[model samples]
Target chain A: MSALELAAAVFLLAGAGFYLAGTLGLLRFPDALSRLHALTKADNVGLLLVCIGLALLAGSLRQAALLLLVWLLALLAATVSAHVIARRALADGAEVEVRDGGGP
Target chain B: MRLGQRLVRGIVLYFALLLVWIVLDGTGDLVVGGAAAALGAWVGLLVAPSKPVRQRLLGALAFAGYFLVESFRGGIDVAWRAARRDLPIDPHLIRYRVSLPPGPARTLLAGALSLLPGTLTADSDDEGALLTIHAITPDPVNAVRALEARIAAWFILPREGAEQEGPT
Candidate 1:
């Protein structure tokens, strides 16, 4: 494979890894809120990397712009939904474990 | 002047929608694209009458840069923690009182915090006075505060007199 193709493959693999890590976080995190963080942040970065890889592979500016647009919309949806879920959990009095010190 | 402002907004929205149509259509068909864009703009105007706030372009660019960097950091931080078998996390909620007004600015702040480092805006009171933010880190107060300042500066909201300092 060409060097560019190799680069794209590497990005795609990294993106998939991030997505796997996000799912692992969702399964392993202690509570709803922490899990929300895992899902939103990790998935966002994962999708972003995937989009970039795909855009590079596509090699068309218009398609790249559209891919970026899709990423933006997904980011928006993820942010809004995650906030809503977290808010509901908090309203339900989801227990939170607070630690002392190490805060400025 | 208000009519003129609305007219200008309508034209801008028309062109923006038309660009989207062209991108989606991918055929350079101006006639259909123009009609669709016009319809879309009219529907947009009818549904959302209020004009968006004037954005400072430089400030927005700066905010975007900061957001991108912070989001990257946030993703790596979470991934690192998730990778650890020990699961080092000290989750807590803090009722953070922000200074931004109760409309778009406040909403933007909440959205920004959720995607930032180890912090998520779980809930805010009815009056938007206190935000119940969940943080994986021990101290998210300073980070939240810094984000608040960044947003305030980005939107060019007045810092004095309108400040509503609530309990932390």
Candidate 2:
């Protein structure tokens, strides 16, 4: 395989690994908020890597830009949804393992 | 806002929507696309109203570049922390009061903080001044401050009394 193709494959593998790690975190983390860390962070990274890999393979600037747009939209969606869920959890008084008081 | 300025903003929004349509729907008819973009801008004006912003071009570019780097680092950081067997999380909810005034700038900050690695904005007060964020890092200070600076750079904010972080 060409160097570019190899690089794409590596990226795709890394992306899948992140996705796996995110799922493990979701299953293993204790609380609602902590679980969200995995979903938002790892999953976002996974999507970003996947997009980069696909963009490299697509070999068109326009398609790469489109992939980037998709990832950004996904990031925005994740941010909003995670915030909403966390707000609801806080309102329900879900157990906060620790809380540092208000700081700058 | 002045009527003239509002008209200009609407026109800009219309063109932006037109570009989006053309790019996403390459084969669609031009007439229909134009009407749709116009309708979208009008509806957007109502649903997602925006205030006049004093954004600096170079500063905005810097912010974007900084954001791209930080976002990638954030992803890798979180992935590493989670993948470890130790888990090493000291999760907590903290209240952070941002310097930005309540508006799009504040909202953008909140959204960004949430998307970053260790901090997730959970709630905000009615004023949008105080944010309740879930933080995993021992010290989110430096990172948060850096991000705030980047965002502050993007929108030329007026200086407050003593904490003057003037446009950079």
Candidate 3:
């Protein structure tokens, strides 16, 4: 495989790792509040990295640029939408129940 | 302030936005584009009939900052819930009565509530005096109570009429 191909693979793998980390965080975190922090931050970063990797692998400047634009737009929309929804949830009054074992 | 100052501020903000857009798009020719955008915005603002709402800059900024942080927190919470195999969810519909009257304040409250984890705006009736919410985690009473408390803090008003009831 070419150097570009190798770089693409690495980026993709790194992104997959991030996604896995987010999933584990979701499962392992004891409380709702803490878990939220782990999933949102990790998954967002993971998806971004994966998109960048795929864009690089496209092997054409025009195609890569288009992919990058799409990625950027998607990220912006996701971020804004996430923020809006979370604010709404807070307004709706959700709470993190205290664990019996006193661990977050 | 004179009309000219308002015009200048609007022009500046518009031009700045256009420039940012150009950089992101990589169109490479910004002078003409920037001028066009600024002119368009200027004309639109001049023709717009509605008066701008008066907001205390500090208060608005604080509210925005708080909303940004809370939304981030909420997004993570939702993602976690979505990934779980055993959905530890207690879905229920709740109606919350709020203190803010039916204007931007109430709309803002409703909009903000729609973002948090496990809660969706089933309906917002009577200009946001009442909000029907579907929550994944249930506990309608407490959810409404907490939501009201947070909103009250953000909007700087005590939610006097806030109450919640579980769906039938």
Candidate 4:
């Protein structure tokens, strides 16, 4: 594979790593709140990295610009979405049993 | 009103957008790119809603920050669930009122909801300001609260006014 392709692959892999981390968090966390937290961080970072990498590999200006635009829009959407889900979980009566009344 | 103020804002937003474009595109010609951005912005203004963009802009940024943190946490949770080899999810339907109320603010909230994982807007009523969200996991209360906080923060809407008890 070409050098650019290699870089793109690395970026994509790293993005996948974030997804893996998210999945791991989802599976391991004891409650919904914790799981929601994991989902937001891993997926958001993963997507951003993957998009940037893809943009780098993209051959045309228009295509790359479109990609960036899409990435930004996705970022905006995801950020709001995570909050909504988390709030919903809380609203649904998910108890926070393990807190020391402070940071973790 | 003044040329300079409008020019400066336009230039700043243009640059922000252009940088994204350049990164996505392998090459850039300053002249052609500048012309294209100018044309694009002009078109953007025409097509954009008549309402002011400032509120929406601020709301969008706040939403972005909120999403990043939540999705990260969500990813970890998903990972853990997979490792356990059990799908312990208690999916259910949740109906809640949207606070931002009918306009750009409301639209932003609706659009953002679709992107979040494990939750879907099952139904919406334009006049009632109600949204029925389907959540994949057990907890629905927190999900609605999170929605409330995020919408309030982004749109600067008052929670007391926008808040309504969830439909049971």
Q: Evaluated with TM-score, which candidate comes out highest? A: 2
Among the numbered candidates, top lDDT falls to 1
For model 4, residues A6-85, the per-residue Cα lDDT tens digits are 98899898888877877776667666655654565567667877886898888776776777678777766665665567
Cα shift from native, residue A36, model 2 (Å): 0.6
Cα TM-score per model: 0.89, 0.89, 0.50, 0.57
Local accuracy of candidate 2 as per-residue lDDT tens digits, B1-168: 677877887899999888777666653587999999999988877765455767899988897787677776777777777778898777887777677765677888888887676888889898667788888777665666677778878887756611533222
Q: Residue B41 CA error for candidate 2 (Å)?
A: 1.7
Q: What docking class should model 2 receive?
A: medium
Interface RMSD of each: 3.7, 3.6, 11.0, 10.3
TM for chain B in all models?
Answer: 0.83, 0.87, 0.60, 0.69
The TM-score between candidate 3 and the true structure equals: 0.50
DockQ of 3: 0.08
DockQ of every model listed?
0.49, 0.55, 0.08, 0.14
Quote the lDDT for B66 in model 2.
76
Off by over 4 Å in 2: A59-61, A97-104, B47-51, B160-168
| lDDT, model 1 | 0.80
Question: Per-residue lDDT for B61-119 in model 4, tens only?
Answer: 87778876655445544445545666555445566666554566566555555445455
Model 4: residues with Cα > 4 Å off, grouped in runs: A1-14, A17-45, A49-70, A73-104, B1-13, B56-63, B114-117, B126-128, B156-168
Looking at candidate 4 chain B, the ten consecutive residues that score lowest on lDDT are: B159-168
Number of the candidate with higher lDDT, 1 or 3: 1
Candidate 3 vs candidate 4, DockQ winner: 4
Residue B49, model 3: Cα distance from true site in angstroms: 6.8
